[model samples]
Target: MRGEEMNFEPMMKMMSLSSIGLMIWIAAQTFTPPKEVVVYVEVPAPVVVTQVIHAPISTARPAPRPDSLCLALNIYHEARGEPLKGQVAVGQVTLNRAAVAYKGASSVCDTVFARKQFSWTHEDPRQPSGAELRPSLDLARKILAGRYIDRTHGALHYYNPHKVDAWWADSYAEVAVLGNHRFMR
Candidate 1:
């Protein structure tokens, strides 16, 4: 009977210890924080595109008229020796004179060829070679095309400063002095 009692006591202690351990494990599972779930979403990257448009190129220049030719000749004879700015000023003056309708002259050609207007026109003016007059010709084309700005500030007359003073210089107001010439309005 003593052996039986001792064996029963040890069995009861083992069962109690196992039951305590089981209760602790269950408490830990109930009290512990839950693990967080992470979700990932993929986004598409933005695409960039570039485009260039080309314009059609013109191969030939338009045919020049008699008035344009006359204006070119006048610029060639008048301001060819001067700087490009001076040539442009001369062209502007011619255009300005044409605008004024001076001495029954209505067009650019008429204004340029008007009696005693340009010194070169007093005589039969010789046509300059294309190679010699290329700069004046180009400038004239730009002026006729209305692509040039007036540098003379609305000047209608210009004269070489080295030359003798003319009676007309006193009548019109002096506007500008460009290169070797003085512009008057």
Candidate 2:
């Protein structure tokens, strides 16, 4: 009870209390679960989403493999047993337009010929007129090369002199071998 007296019992009790607290802490740590846990997972069914990307599509199809529009036309006409002279004349018209020192533009008119132009009227007898007068070099080249003869109705066809017929002409007489003046070797 004195101020200067040593408190042994109190000190002993405090030490005991601390030792009990330490024992409890150690026991809790010893019984603790592992640091990492394991789990099982399953994947669900695959999901497919269709996305459309914008790209240019050519409504026009591939044409024949002739080098000159005239030749292809001739081949087509000759194949059908039609007149070769007219086909060649058509080809010549194309070349003439191509060589026009006066027109100052390429004779090739297949690209810009409107639907209502002179060439669009198939039964008009003047199918080979105006811009359509020129033969398509692209058409000729296809005939010459002996490639696919598209002859499709729409944008693909040998431009008739004035007619816009979609019917395909044969390439027998018109399609001649290169430099041989003949369709086949």
What digit string (tens of lDDT, one per residue) describes model 1 on residues 54-138? Answer: 2122223446677778888899888888887888889889999898887888799999999999999988778788787777777
**Which candidate has the top score in TM-score?**
1
Candidate 2 overall Cα lDDT vs. reference?
0.34
Report the poorest 10 consecutive residues by lDDT, candidate 2: 36-45
Summarize candidate 2's per-residue lDDT along 79-170 as a digit string, tens digits.
22334443443444334334442245343443223234223233343333324433434445643443543222112123432333434345
User: What is every candidate's alpha-carbon RMSD to the true fold?
Assistant: 34.3, 31.0
Task: Estimate TM-scores for all models.
Answer: 0.63, 0.23
Best candidate according to lDDT:
1
For model 1, the stretches where C-alpha displacement exceeds 4 angstroms are 1-63
> What overall lDDT goes with each candidate model?
0.71, 0.34
